[model samples]
Target: MDLATIWVTFTSWAGAYSWQVIVTLAIVGLYFLIDRLTIPVLSRSADNARLTESSGDRAVGLARLLTGTLCALAMMVVWGVQFGSVLVFAGTALTLLGVALFASWSILSNITAYFVILLHPTFRRGTFIRVLDADNYAEGYIADLGLFNLKLITENREAIVYPNNLLLGRPCVINPRDRLRGVGKLPPLPPLDVVPNNE
Candidate 1:
């Protein structure tokens, strides 16, 4: 084609899809900005929760996964994917996932609990804790926090892999003296009962 003809063709094509290109770029840029803002917040929360660096990293990874998923969905919408179709597909996939996970409900619970432990101040790595279960009471130093369980090293050196869900439900006693190995001190706890019995 002649230069004028090529130029015309290129301009027409670009004009036809310019909106799509802009929307795509905007969606991607928005995701990047959100990711940058979110990661440090998660990391800071992890630090406040007394989670290990590895745990903080894992939390950041999870946040990234969620962010990416949302961004993908937005891109699909921006690119003119039918929302109803997307919903149907997502629902079907989730229903299948629910059935598959039903048999391993505890596993799912533990995975959820992993984030809870990472973001909450109650359970942290390296501290000593006692799980008060009538039948399976256990005490140990927090060794590692895994996706499905918390690893604990007992005073006798026995390693215990306690499921995160169980820990969440059970009564836990944290030893104030057994702060995280590298963390200098434990954050101050709330008052014993936040009240005095004047009766």
Candidate 2:
């Protein structure tokens, strides 16, 4: 095409989509900035809550998911996606996802349990805990609270990857003791509340 024709097409395209471009850029930039700030704050919050380092990481992951979803919705708005279409798409996607993961109900339950564990002050990293079950009992140092599981390190240094839902389901005892108490440098342990099973 001639220069005038090319110029006309370019200006028309830019004029038509300039606002979309600006909004998309703004949304993306804000998402990154929020992500950078949010992860560190969440990690610090987790640490202050005496959660495991990996739990902090899981918090970061959850933050990213929420922030990313918001960013996607903002971009969709900028692109003028219809509200009804958004609803239909979201419903269909969730239905498919639920159908796909329906057999793994424990996974969903464990994820929901993560918050329960987080809010429980007595259940945290480095705490000595015992889980009692009718069939068998387990006691260990609470190590990490993951997305789908709680990791416990036993007296013999064996790792027990307990499901989060199951851990919450069973009766738990919190016995406070420093994992490195015998070592010279570690400080004395604080008074941790013992939540006994009233069964």
Clashing residue pairs for model 2:
none
Give the alpha-carbon lDDT of every model. 0.75, 0.76
Q: Model 2 over residues 1-199: C-alpha lDDT tens digits? A: 9999999999999899999988899999999999988777767667766876778887778779868986897788678899779878878877765654343454676766776677667786888887767645677888888878888888788888888878888887688443432112324358899999899
For candidate 2, give the lDDT of residue 73. 78
What total of clashing residue pairs does each candidate reach?
A: 0, 0
Residue-level lDDT of model 1, residues 148-177, one tens digit each, is 789888877888888988888888879845
TM-score of each: 0.69, 0.60
Worst 10 residues of 2 by lDDT: 178-187
- Model 1 clashing residue pairs (backbone): none
**Distance from true location, Cα of 166 in model 1, Å:** 2.2
